[model samples]
Target: MNEAWQQALSRVPELLAAHVQISVSALALAMLICLPLAIWAARSPRVAAVTLTIASLIQTIPGLALLALFYPLLLGVSALIGGGISAFGFLPALLALTLYALLPILRNAVTGLTGVDPAAQEAADGLGMTGSQKLYYVEAPLAAPTIMAGIRTAAVWTIGAATLSTTVGQPSLGDLIFAGLQTQNWTLVLAGCLFSAALAISVDLLLGLIERGIRERRRIWAWAGLAMIAAGLLVATLPLMIARDNIVVIGAKGFSEQYILARLIGSRLEEAGYAVRYRDGLGSAVVYQALSEGDVDVYVDYSGTIWTNQMQRSDNLPKAEMLEAIAQWSSHSHGVKMLGALGFENTYAFAVRPEDARAKSLRTLDDLARVSSDFNFGTDVEFLERPEWQMVRDAYPIRFKNARSFSPTFMYPALVSGEVDVISAFSSDGRIAANGLVVLADPKGAVPSYEAILLLAPARAGDQKFVAAINPLIDAITVDNMREANYMVDREGDKKTPRQAARWLNEKLRE
Candidate 1:
């Protein structure tokens, strides 16, 4: 436990810096747009109503959904203009968070400006002051306190929402949170939450000081608050300013296997003298798109995922033919290189408790279908939406009494606790065996092959050193070794960090 906390703490500086950078940038951008708009809206009630309504509508959209929505929107725009815009990472996250911060700042600023004393405005007019002069000398100072209050609110909100940017591929404290949740590592989750909450609280306190300073007419207090914030931002940005070359950005989906593989890949790259960074917890579609766009240098993707999700193919082919077709399509269509399979499969398997399987005489999909109406199905959050699930439903007459979604980490526990009768388990997950669950046979072959495949970005496809560095991984990891590695991380007692598990797997490859 102490070691786990140490490992989790070691990562905090980099993640916290990234979290601060994005939060501050979004807040600053929100202020830039909102303050100007507020000045205009203060003069026109119609403008105020419309702008505020739009901001409110934006707020109504869930942060995660808003972040996810931008990927396709930006992709469409990029396609229309011949594809230069990146739909992943900082841009999408920035845009979503900026929009989120708008309402608080805009509403408060407008309220402050419009609510300025009428007598003061008259006095300025009587003094023959021009409109701009009145605003600059009189209205602005009086409105400063309220405007700062809005900024304080916006700062806290932006800091909180910025954590969601991890989904869009931006590195933030949320990476720790999301990865922890997936792996059930409470230490990591606690570390992420603690740092994020601390940063938000600190920023709010500083901004509150500025607000108070303005209200109390204390310039020293305001300057002191501003100085501290400047210092903090400088500290946060220093690491980013240092120039580093040949940095490889690895992308991974939200699961233990993906995390382990990413670290394994990173370890190999680092041995080859490349600086490494990871973008974990990417969605299935988003990770592939990111690689194709060169936002990610390399990552592992399943052959079946590329086939059904990317190729839009419904028909099943032999494993070799499917891999060949996927490779050809990826190289030709998107310039992505299908490096090779990792000699293992993590296909979705319908697993039930061994006792239940025996009691129901369920050994296959056909058997499961016979008793489906009495069972409750549990799946990873994405499985129900995946093409594989739809294909299974089409192939089988199975219809569960109820279905629920959970994080991959919780699905096995749900099965063990009898909260769920069955789950869409990964064939390579160790917990399936650990819990002695039985995976129903798919005699119909409706589910496509899901051999784990490494993919390279277009730019790296021709790089011999890059290719050679990763080539050893092809056909290296057996399913047994992978399950062992995953179990090392996923197991409740004496859990290994993904990096440690990767190291253990790498040693197995050597043997």
Candidate 2:
């Protein structure tokens, strides 16, 4: 196997532990709540109808949407309660997964309880059993098989949906999948998928065996299956129990470059004798929010992203001026410290294949304007919604044949394949040079320079060691180094895992 695949496999134990914890925790919590509610509902027709309807309603919300919605919901609750609950990570993921798990378990439990034989209840009552005794001795055993089936179904659903937690800053197998998909690394994606599938299948089979055992009045299979689950939970949560202090949390946005940078930062912190954990693949806005809220310790963000998106500025300032403005604004407004630029700019640039640029004799935005009608434009999803694009459009008389948005991962492939004639590309992206694309110059200076900058969370701003430790990296990474690191992971034939790429970059930085 290749180094990339080997790296991918190395992560399975850690990722699987996370995935299992998330899945089992959510399923276990759901069962605890749903089973009792199911019992109560089985005894009362009105309660059963109301509870089932609510659970079914929760199930109808798309899993991703449900997960995203929890951020603001908990944010508000946190404020109202004077701050305790975290709006991101395990809490929200758990809540969303538990909600998703509820319908299946609740419905199945209700079905099982309600379907209990009337004759059996009468027989239990004739034997001098009270209501609770009848339920324990007669109804529960009769209902065990069906209830277990519901739990099995819910377990599968919980495990599958738990992967989405990666988007909300909780690490799981989905980290591998999301990072892989972004970098077009299928090995990581496939590994994550296979691991998650195998886990679900294994859990389902064990639960199925337990269900069959209960129905046949065989205690051994049921006890053995339950023991396996308990052991897995213990194994999954052991890391969390041991590592509880002196850890730095690093955040990264969803892309190859961010992943590489996060790993670089993590390795540096680890080498400094600090335990480092990452919350990778956070949304651009979400990462900043997490940092400011102290949910994450540090991350790299571009100047222009903070300038226009976070700061809401529209002026096209020079790089130094913009960087200074962002530093001051962030410090004053959000208590976040913009340590310094990373000595590289990853700005928005319009790029075309070299062949297309040469055929059109295009060298600048002005040249593009003359032939704009012939080319279709492509951009990552945020560009169209960003003020930078509006500035560029208003500055030039350029009108493309069509414009479409793609995820960052797909944007370059789309451009290279002729799906789009021009792409609003990130200047530092490795694929731009790797694929031989020419970025058009903007003589009019319509776009802002996106110099990569390091940001510190409010809680860590005063930590002298933390700040000092990261200072060396501020001006260390150049555009060339970044692009090369990105290309190592993103290029089709030559692949390096993010950690390996980070190690390579660290070697260069030391020199």
Candidate 3:
């Protein structure tokens, strides 16, 4: 391995540390939020049924959606409290993760607590033990194992779901998995996934040991196991939790695609022994604002998104000029430095089902415009509101009879189902090939060049070694590799993660 890989391995401790905080803090908060409800419900069949119904309802929503659900709630709260307390960052992550963590914990705690012998309860009452005293001395001690089992379930689930926190801009192993997948960097992704697995396994084992101790009351094993887990967490999180030091925060836009690029850069920076924080999943406007306000120090950003969405400039400059002008604007106006472009593009491409495009002669945006009033469109939530669409509409003079937005995850299937005749797909997305869709040409130059660039916080531009180490790696990624990497995940039966995909990218680049 090279120096960067060796160093990346070294910072596994830091990654683990950040991982534990999310898991533990969320678990702790979950216990406070859920345990009481569990106990109260445990006192009666009706209440228990009600409590279970609510907790189980939460479980039905997918982890990523559950996490996204909390953003609005926390955003409202943050608005009330106002001075940079963001729902889009760590708080929503923590809260949503905690909620996702609750069902197993509450369900198990209720089962264990109520499972205690009825005779034991009667005897405690006959002996005049108060309810609190019975709970403390008799019931709780015996129920500890069952409660701990719930905690174990919560622990594993918490870590797994915590990975999705990358969706909401919370950094954890998902950063590696998601970002690594985007660029097909498995080495980096493996580093993330293995550490995450190791953490979950290690935590599970430790909790298992504790549960056994509680069942057996073996004080030595209990104290020893708990102590080791605690000590390990303290050491692991020290660097990331220590935020006052001179650190650069790199951000990614909130999507699977952005997750890949951001994580690759963030993980590499941490490996180089520089401190880094990630602000991911921030809205298009919010990311630039954070960069301007100096909340986040650096991040991976798109050329087209910045041009059309952020700056409202709509010319298709040569790739070099576009990068130069954006970087110049960032530097001159906001003190941000666009380091250099990663050798990949994720521009908006209009696509149609292969059979339909073939049958209809719809090979380009110009073709679509002529028949725009007949075809329907499907796309992600943000794309519908973005200026690129307006520009495309104006330049190509296009319109469709019906248009709808769905999460990127659902768009391809919608097209396949004929629910939409056409959709705006990302150029780098694997779904293009996986689903047999045709990416129509932008023959009239409707869309701008959107090469991916690594933007640094103005102050971070000072580090030459930091800049040198990253530029080479970023410059190596290609659009085709990104498609294959994502296909490993989105394509059926692949089951590979972003990290696995990233490994392939890194290997190919080395070749």
Best by lDDT: 1
**Candidate 1, residue 160: how far the Cα is off, in Å:** 0.9
TM-score of 1: 0.98
Worst 10 residues of 1 by lDDT: 237-246
lDDT of 3 at 146: 94
What's the CA RMSD for each of the models?
1.3, 2.5, 7.1
When 2 and 3 are scored with TM-score, the better candidate is 2
Task: Output the TM-score of candidate 3.
Answer: 0.68
lDDT of 3 by residue, 1-511 (tens): 8643663476566556667888889999999987788778778889889888888998899998888777667657766887466665578789888888888988988898899999998999999999889988777887789989999999999998888887666677776666555444466668888888888899999999999988898988888889988898888788766656767677777566665566566666777887766655566765775676566777777898788766778667887888888988888887888878878898999989888887888898888888889888998888877778877988897878999998777888899999998999999998898888899998777789889888776666777877865776667887888787767766657346444555566666622
Q: Can you tell me which runs of candidate 1 are displaced by over 4 Å?
A: none
lDDT of 2 at 196: 91
- Screening candidate 1 with a backbone cut-off below 3 angstroms (N, C-alpha, C), the clashing residue pairs are none
lDDT (C-alpha) at residue 497 in model 1:
93
Give the candidate number with the greatest TM-score. 1
TM-score of each: 0.98, 0.92, 0.68
Instruction: Report the Cα lDDT for candidate 2.
Output: 0.88
- In order, candidate lDDTs are 0.92, 0.88, 0.78
Model 2 misplaced regions, further than 4 Å:
124-133, 366-373, 397-399
